[model samples]
Target: MGIKKEIEIRCHPLMSWDISNPILSLKSRTKEDLKLLSELSKQNNWEVDFAKELAMSYQTLVLTDLQQTILWVNAGFQTMTGYTADYALGKKPTFLQGEKTSEKVKSRIREKLSKGRRVSETITNYKKNGLAYDCLITIIPLLDSNQVITHYLALEREAA
Candidate 1:
């Protein structure tokens, strides 16, 4: 006589199955990201799910008010900039700039943002530790149902 046994492992949709691995399954990650998007959408009154795909593509996802004050930042922002969300909140993105940053590029970015146009630029940004890194930034204006710009979303990745 022979007996056969099988074991099945089930994991919570919000958690990683591999306890030693920090990275989550794609499905779990998506669920978590959607939850965050839902909260942001509810709080800001904007449909932000459109950015779900972009949330993981960039190293940092920064949300700022129309006045350019930081509202939120994803975990990658802390990994890349050495600054926590608590420290970055309420601060202008310019706080990441340093003496080595380009004035011309800053002027161009300001002009584009003021015109409600999207801006994509590679610029120098300083980390909390005072180290400079080249970052590629893409800023898009977030609009409400009425098409009124209420916030800005910046996707940033460290330039190779």
Candidate 2:
């Protein structure tokens, strides 16, 4: 499919942004999703290009602030986790963890993230429906132009 070039101006309390025009024809995205992407790009001085690419390649995308508070999630996240963006927002990713989750793996991930490293792990994660599934997660520390870690981008998919 070809790319769709559309100009949309969305206003938020902090700022107003005109999305970079041509949005990829990967999937159906809501206006809030587009606005979140725009805000993330503007706030971090990063391009939304990578997000678009990742959206197509990954089943789920989770964006979290430095404190690990969830900032945004792509539509695939809801499909995969059975949790809406409204419910997931402001919550840490740990909320997905349950008794079946491994403490050792969690510790290792924490160690890597604390040092600003990228981590990949396959761990058991609980869905909103109380079912556990093996999930492969890749967490990358997002850096600003100043070379400081500002946020994290986690790409997740069910482990086969």
Candidate 3:
């Protein structure tokens, strides 16, 4: 792997902080930013555009169909996983998994997905170059108006 890829995989932000006071970092929020955040807080999964915009931020976010096929991924995902959208789209997220990825974790994730429940777990995942790293992945089931699962939205951040 190149220096850029190694740096990308290792330099991701870790979720080991005490950020209970998130409002402390809102010192420069524009009116529009506040409005967007308010709107997102009220939205579930029906708002695709809003979700896409939210995913475009620093945290890695990915969307997959109910069948687990990748639909879209944010730029942050590309930076962190070393898989560009062109190569990642239309593939399953498991393409990033390797021998180090625990089968127990995969089974747990599948069980939660089958039950249409949100899953939060720290698991080993590989980058495009096959280098493994720990990620705290939160997968939220997206439901249609009739309460049927339509998709899944995954937010991933580095874990120790």
The digit string of per-residue lDDT tens for model 1 on 17-47 reads 5333545543444454456656556655774
* lDDT by residue for model 2 (1-160), tens: 1011111122122111222332442243434555555666666765335645455345677888888988767766766898977788779999999999999999999999999888999889999999999999988787777778877888888887
Q: Indicate the residue-level lDDT of 26 in model 2.
A: 27
lDDT of each: 0.71, 0.71, 0.64
- Over 1-160, each residue of candidate 3 has an lDDT whose tens digit, in order, gives 5322322343223222313433332222223233433343344335344434444323466667777887666545766798886687778999988889999999999998899888988889898888899988888786655677777878787775
Show where candidate 3 strays beyond 4 Å: 1-58
TM-scores vs. true structure, each candidate: 0.76, 0.73, 0.67
Q: Order of candidates by lDDT, top first?
A: 1, 2, 3
Show the lowest summed lDDT stretch of 10 residues, model 1. Answer: 2-11
**Candidate 1: global Cα-lDDT?**
0.71
Q: How accurate is candidate 2 locally (lDDT)?
A: 0.71
